[model samples]
Target chain A: MASLKDRIGVIKLNQKVAKDIYKMVLQFDDMPDDIKGGQFAHVKLNDKSHILRRPFCICDYDISAKTITLCYAVVGDGTKVLSSYEVGEKLQVMLPLGNGFTPDKNVKKVVLLGGGMGSAVLPAIPTSNPELEYYTYLGFANKEKVVLEEEMAKVSKQLTVATDDGSYGKKGFVTNILAEDMAKLKPDVVFCCGPEVMYKALKKALEPFDVPIIVSLEARMGCGIGACLVCNCKVKRAGEEETYVRVCVEGPVMKLSEVVL
Target chain B: MSNLKVNIAGVEFKNPIITASGTFGFGREYDRFYNIEELGGICTKGLTIKPKLGNPPPRIAESYGGMLNSVGLQNPGVDHYLQKDDLYLAKRDVVVIANVAGSTLDDYIAIAEKINGSKSDMVELNISCPNVKEGGMAFGVLPQSVERVTSAVKKACPNKPIITKLSPNVACIADNAKAAEAGGADAISLINTLSGMAVNYKTRKPILFNNNGGMSGPCVKPVALKMVWDCYNAVKIPIIGLGGITSYTDVLEFMICGARAVQVGTYNFNNPYGARDIAKDLATYVEENNMDINDLVGTLILNK
Candidate 1:
């Protein structure tokens, strides 16, 4: 269990990377050198109206520069406020929160699937484990929403992009493409992070493969620590009744089979 | 350091800043950010006779200057807490206050009996949880029920002091505080979250899974302060004030109004190190003012 800390991070960059999505790079003097793949940063906004801090997955971290990059969509009041922050401004954030993805050491082949803003967390996978053979599948609503292709490509052995509208890449759902490539890819493990709808579809699409799947779930959180119990997800344990686990603690990342989703 | 020590009932706290129940989970999670022993006391999450899974997804909704929570009392039962968390909490140099909730009188008694003479320094009777369907807010709304529940728990736990936590949703908050004191409660803590609800306009439905939730944060400070003041004047027993407490200034305000100690609730979520920082700031404030921390309690003057 990595210890969580509140650090005042200086925003080095805050700019739009895609439609309605902006990327922020923050520099912290005392951040942990290594943050897990699926871990997120709980960012506090300047506006007092929004009491709860917004949780965003860590897109990447630069240890040498002591910086962490976060990519988020301007969906709510918190993000809207965050988008307006300029460089040199101090942002308070709790870092390296929740249980991140655990890549199996014995597994040789890996598949990473991300959708929309979910693509933000995929880039860290290959960066953390450079030895593993990787395949990336990214899904977007349209071509305009697509992002992080060049960054993910630098790390993945094979990268595939899918859009709902046939504007860029394949014309269909990313899970459909995942289904087609499962046999050929024969990935030993699969990691996914996206919308709830995508997880529901991927749960069925990857059911036949018998490969272990890890997923990073997102929820509106009060305290990004385990205390508040606001961000809960149903998890079914072996030989026990279904129970709720805090997404901020037990996971943002969990085994597909363990989660009730 | 200006005599930060304060005694609640027979239990002694190093300072007047205790982490509120439900916000601090057995002192482990927040310990990662700061030392739990830095505070005066820690109130564990609302424990029950049986383990609770709590409400479904979307248990929280952010409101103006506050947030609503429908996380009903989610805990691994009193037995589990004693078995797993008691030893760990006991080893720490802080007072451990067990905050217990139940659906029925027997449920309260069962948990009280389990915690009696345990490692817990005190028992905080949480009869004001609004998220549960039965028992919680019911026992807290009326003065008679509040007295009944407080007396029952007081009888059950003979060794530990019982602090009845009163709800603010009632018609008269001071009457409930006096009721707890009349029922043999050792002390009183007031202004548990006020019952409220939030809606998503697009869906035209409540945001919380439980439909209604308890609202706590800076938004409830004035309401909490008044309740604490009213309760202080109503009862001779000490009052632990809470409701949207965020900083040392809020703590001072609560103390001056009549709270012997203040509990940091929703502010814990906003900043994990809030209690620690406030404690330090309070010490500095006391030193700068050239007064002991005790002198600040119940110092508010009524305007003629």
Candidate 2:
């Protein structure tokens, strides 16, 4: 493996575009070059106490602007420290850490589903796909927790939202809405990134439908590399009941059928 | 500046800071963050006669204040390490201590003999890995076996310093340290990991595939420090202390209680730059106190 620490350069902390979430973007001259959709970057907050790096999936890769956008929730100490960075301060980041999704030629129609912070990586991919028809499905706990609705709607050919509290869009879960639109959308492939329960529920719903499916899994990660096997999830292997693979290295993305879910 | 430098047998280390084997992984990954050469030394990943693929998935699990691991001593063999010509570490300047494990006494002897002729600064006999099915902690638990392996490696690698790493899984760490000393070991490193298990309440099964694993991290510091103190009082040989040392205070506790040098393990997983931060923080502590680092060693007074 290439130890390309140089791939990440000094990215100035732009500003706190959202509460508890800083909207820092990479500005390296060489960055945004060849940065494909669905990739991730390792962000390091300049703090002595929180030493390990944190990984974030790419929200938007602007090759022209030489920037990548990432919106993360400040759930722990690392992100809490990260939120302290101001517009001029610099931080070290390792970009494009994992393998991202590539739109298949035969699979023209795609549906993107995301929930909570999982909604971060959705806008960058299917919304930007020019050749294929793509629809975005999002789920949130309530209207107050809903995010990126306008941005997603701007890019997707059709947008559907579901809130558990029945506060916005449709009542009940996102998968329920997908079940209603399964016939008209006729998506060739389904891509999902969300909470474990959300993914687990979606997995069961999509099981009967025959199509290529890809999912991004989340786990507690120390190093955004394969060396430390801290970030692993159960994956089914041929002849074997189940095996754990690193979510950081083997994937953030896996085929619906290939993964045990 | 405080004298943080320490000596094992005749070999010298610039400071009491040493990176634990397996956790540091041959010193390749962490170098990406800081200059590894600044630390005292590095105990490489546990190497066997032949390369090991390690255990299956679910090798690590987190606990309240610590973590458990069943890495199963995965590493390329002794010959492979020698063949690399230290290419991965060419640019760095640090003492490279080779950690060796074997199924039998002969296995330890063979690996020790090979490391004696290699660039490794010292030979750390792995008599205490709880994750492995056999031949690791098994060799360290029984006093007779500890003596047997220590003596075997000492006899095979007379030129190199042989530090027998002790297992906390035993009934008494002090007795194990004494056995290693009597067996002719130059030094001893303690508390490999207390045997532990974390049950998934819903599944009602153990978290690790091995059913049990070695616990390391902040959770076990007190247990490790107590073991180090006990072993330090029991044996004349230098004690290399390790167990969930994540801060300057933890390092100081190890030193004051008679650890010649300290190793940072599980904390590496929590923080990639853990070693560097601890080194800096320890140095600052040493300077702020207006005392030498050696002054901290074995200063623990056992109440009569």
Candidate 3:
């Protein structure tokens, strides 16, 4: 079973990786064996004043070392508070949450796409499914906002990084870059995580391709275990009325076609 | 003489800690963390006459010490709950209270009558759902409306005890409690989420998609305890106190302030094992003290 109970994780490393972004690796006493990529960890800061626990994608994990890394941006008071914590300080973290990305048995080749902080979700996919071949494309606003390019490259068969401005690699959206390369790459399936806007763009851009597109969604969550219906996203499949599914339960990852953008 | 049990409206609970409605969804989600049977009782997610789709995305937002949510009471209609979760909860060792909601009096009666045939031990009326009748006022806001709905549902589901869950967004919460009692309600639960909102200064927009949401967490405990005391003094029926209860001491505070029992809400979001852990802590405290937990009810020593 997944680790459903809260576990204390001592901060092993907490440092800035990019502008407004900090990557913190938490060392736990032990963890469950079945943690998959695309799953998230709900983190509670030390003080009880901040009642809601912030949900962060399990960017990567080292089961042998009993550590899960969380990559987050200083968006508000909760994250700013998270950034100030020092090494050896502990946070209450519930890991291996939500239904993670699990491709079909026959699937072999894969395409990984990330946009900025969403790239944090890509590295763990390869760690979980090391047998599958991966081609990666990453997008960021500019050089200052880019993150996890190096981490993603290690897991991908081939990697492409682009920034909106000419300040970095390519000078346009990564989705457009991937669209240009779709026929040549010809991967079995595509997995992406980015802002909601990116999902819409990817849906339209990849409409020509026959490949299945899966995307991870982010929502303001309460009770990341699905008890509280706070983290809901709408999904509409063929011949079905639109229904809200808990991002914390049915998914943080869902098929792009099914998610009502 | 260690007794952690409490009786509310003739329903005997194993303990005084019931997971609040809307927080515990038919006891399925939290059961994965710990055996939910360990808690005293569970007020299930609010059920409507038909399945409610609720509000759009971004239904939740965070504050300094609390959170705001505009879930719009999205639930798989009463028939769905009866067909699915009711069977699952029937086997649990815990007391199951089916929380029902509706947009009108007919809706409340129809849903209550449906739940009366189910396996739930009690019914909690979540009158916080906005009503279209009477100038779009919520059923829980006005004392007259509280009594009207409570009595109708009480008669409709005569087999089950009725707990009119009051909204704290109203004036004179005590009068509402009295209204529930007058409507022949067996018990009353107070106070539901306080009406509030969280905003974004830069965008000049509200964080929730619904533009407004209900606030709950550790911050609302003071407001909840005061209301519980007010209602306890005003009504003869049992009162189930809730709001931002995070610890066993918070449970004790509710009981001392005249709550027959207390419910743990938002803290369940913080720790999945929160409600069960609190029940365990309360048991240990009572065991160590060798006292009956019920003795603490209405024992607050108010200074002159």
DockQ of each: 0.77, 0.17, 0.73
- The TM-scores, one per candidate, come to 0.98, 0.74, 0.97
Which lDDT tens digits does candidate 1 get at residues B154-261? 999999999999989899989998899999999999888988999998899999988999999999999999889888889999999999888899998999999999
Candidate 1: where is the Cα deviation over 4 Å?
A: A1-3
Rank ordering of all candidates by lDDT, starting from the highest: 1, 3, 2
Clashing pairs in model 3, backbone N/Cα/C closer than 3 A: none
Better candidate by lDDT, 2 or 3: 3
Best by DockQ: 1
For model 3, report the TM-score of its A chain: 0.98
Q: Using TM-score as the measure, what is the rank order of every candidate, best first?
A: 1, 3, 2
**Per-residue C-alpha lDDT of model 3 across residues B184-291, encoded as one tens digit per residue:** 899999888877878899999998888888888999889999999999899989999999998899999999999989899889988888899999999999999999
- For model 2, report DockQ: 0.17
Q: State in Å the error of residue B171, model 3.
A: 1.7
Which RMSD does model 3 reach against the true structure? 1.7
Assign candidate 1 its CAPRI class: medium
From the highest DockQ down, the ranking of the candidates is 1, 3, 2
Which lDDT tens digits does candidate 2 get at residues A103-174?
777988889998777888787785356577778999988886677788788778899888888988888899
Clashes of each: 1, 0, 0
- The DockQ-based CAPRI class assigned to model 2 is incorrect
